[model samples]
Target chain A: MQPTETFFSGFAPHDLWFLGEAALRTLWLSLLAISIGSMIGVVFGWLLSVSRIGGGFVLSPLLDIFRSVPLIIQLVLFYNFAPIIGLRLDAFDAGLIVLIVYTSANVAYVARGGIEAVSQPMRRAARSLGMTYWQDMRYVVWPIGLRAVFPAWVGVALGVMKDSALVSVLGYVELLKASQILITRTQETILILAIAGAFYFALSYPISLYAAHLEDRWNQ
Target chain B: MDYNFHWRPVFKALPDLLQAALLTLEVAAISMILGVLIGLGLSLIRIHMKGPVMWLASIWVELARNTPALLQLFFFGFGLGAFGIHFSPYLIVLMGLTFNNAGYLAENFRGGFGAVPDTQIRAARSLGMTAFQTYTRIVIPQVLRIVYYPMTNQMVWAVLMSSLGMLVGFRELSGETQFFASRTFRIFEYFAVTAVIYYIIVKIILGASRLLAMRLFRY
Candidate 1:
């Protein structure tokens, strides 16, 4: 017990390796979730921004309800409910699905803003050139819309990375969960946590800095 | 076809949930108060200070803002135990919430401060106002008006994130919901009630903030 205790001291080589592995897992999950979620977000956002509420006030209300529910509740629902429907997922898969859906809700908002930022004059110009609505969107609207909202996408991406840690509640072996495990196993809680904190900082800082840079560039 | 909804259990659980809801409100309220003070101080330093102080503030803000609040809670709760700095679970939760909220609030405040036009600052200085007076009397009030919406948004996020306190054994609303779910094996009911309470709290906070903004900043 004494050697085992002494061997697993704070900042030990093996512990550092463990932390590194955890960080990698965290990054992987964040990337996977964000990639899938952002794709869905773009489509949902396009529809949200373009759809006219001619008669279906019902659609808007449903979107409101979906957006209002907490992400954690959504996670728990998918975790438990999916099994009963025979679409069983492991904890990781369930967490990933929850993150994708939850993040898509937010991304859709950003996307809508992005799409709406394109000027009416640009649309008219595209139409005058004999372009159809779909062609105008493909050739003119989307490019400008995406550029205008690039900074917003950066913010949303940072959000996804931070929220990825929440999946640890369901026992996923992400960086935060790994830190919890280390605390129980090695008893060097503070040092390991500090390392975990540094890992998160490493992941998030550059993205935020890049967002700030893009905002400056665009504003100028 | 045989399924029938029952309100009896949900109604019976209300008093317990309400007690826990009180705890949740207490945590969010206290943390937001403290967070605003600390955040304002940090924002001042970030904006007005030079060199090392600004860098230190930036680092602190980045670290707190970037990580998940749950990780911060765990670090403060379990991590501190290793350094012989144990806090009660409630205190740890409060500390984590305050630290996390302060980071975002500082940024919101910094953005607000930026919104204060430079010409006004120059005008105040030209009229023989000290830098401190210019900031307090001329800049901060205007900045507050500009930041009202974003600040409200941050407050809403803070309230929502407070639910994470349950992970560290703090018996806030989410924790109580988990307890009920496990005890009664009525996971769906417990969670449904939790979601409704959260939605109501968020809506109330938003409404109250909007009202306060109108009252305070009405020109």
Candidate 2:
């Protein structure tokens, strides 16, 4: 690529395409992190519910480290530390690893709360009805507990989506990073930022509205 | 993995990093104070006002909550520069954090206000207290008690969110860590210690909050 001569240019039509692609990267990263993280988190949460001694002593504090630190710091630490440990990971891979751990740490707490929200007597009733342990969980606990925790899970998912913007610090060209590029090149900081902010608002607002709607319906 | 670990530079930089950590807490504390004031006004306006003013508060709350904090910091930095209104990196971070905190806290305040039943306000007014007096003497105390825990959480959030200042070139704890880490190329060693410092700061805030809660809530 040749160095361009111009210091500032007008916003051309193609910047929209760049923003779109970057938004997709943000979405894709968040989706991958939330799905994998939630699965691991659910299992961790189950272990917590089933075995108090092991989970409380060992697993809880381990997860707390991820929650307590800022996501930006965690990204920088992992991105830099990976090479030292012989893992030749790229920016995207390293960020995904960190985000997945971060997501699971958050979701594990929410999932544990959801499981415990289902009263012990309700589970006991299911077991007394000749339901196996797995059967009791799959049938009674899953549906009831999910309703109680779905809104909280949605909050975590949205939070992860917004936080995926931090991956840009690692040089993965996500939406926020793309805006920075456009702003520097075009000298149209406000316009490009407004466009980028709109993309985030568009992506986030509707799901939150839907979550609120679901919460209202469930309460009724 | 033949990377040589270096703790010497990190140990030497501990004092600078600790000072930066104090700056982090300072800005966060200032922002929290400003945010709570703005947030309280916003909640009251949303509940009591009408037309364009209410819309303005609603817009602020929605924009702040729906977007990323880093983006919001960028908005205060480069976005305002478009209008020829440039802010120093410190101002940019302070504005961004205050904006974000007020949005979230407004929602919490609104919820707290709702939890205080209308009947008490009516009762206070029926006793010939003025509207302002009713709120100040009766309503606000209850609202404050209800929202105290959420306020503590928001304070911790302010500290965490202020770390974004590094991106905007504010030399807070994370920025200082990044500065030293880059200079020495001891990225892992520098950041590992920085992470522990962040953990300690968060723990202190949580511990202090617990003690305050006990003192305030005791019957």
Which predicted model would earn the best TM-score? Answer: 2
TM-score of each: 0.91, 0.97
- How far off is each candidate at the interface, as Cα RMSD in Å? 2.6, 0.7
Q: What would the per-residue lDDT of candidate 1 be over residues A5-54, giving only the tens digit for each residue? A: 35354446887788788788888888988999999888778778767672
Highest lDDT scorer: 2
Candidate 1 local lDDT, B1-219, one digit each (tens): 332445567679999998998888888888988988889989999988989988988877888888777778887888777779989878998999899888988998999988888999999999999999998999988888877787777777766777787777778888888887778776766778788888888878888987897899777
- True-contact fraction in model 2 equals 0.76
Instruction: Give the per-residue lDDT digits (tens) of candidate 2, residues A1-220.
Output: 9978887888999989998999999999999999999999999888787877789988998888887789999999999899888898998999999999999999998899889999999999999999999999999999999999999899899889999999999999999999899888889888899999999999888998899899989989
Question: How far in Å is the alpha carbon of A23 misplaced in model 1?
Answer: 2.6
DockQ of 1: 0.53
The lowest-lDDT stretch of 10 consecutive residues in candidate 2 chain B is B210-219
State the TM-score for model 2.
0.97
Complex DockQ per candidate: 0.53, 0.85
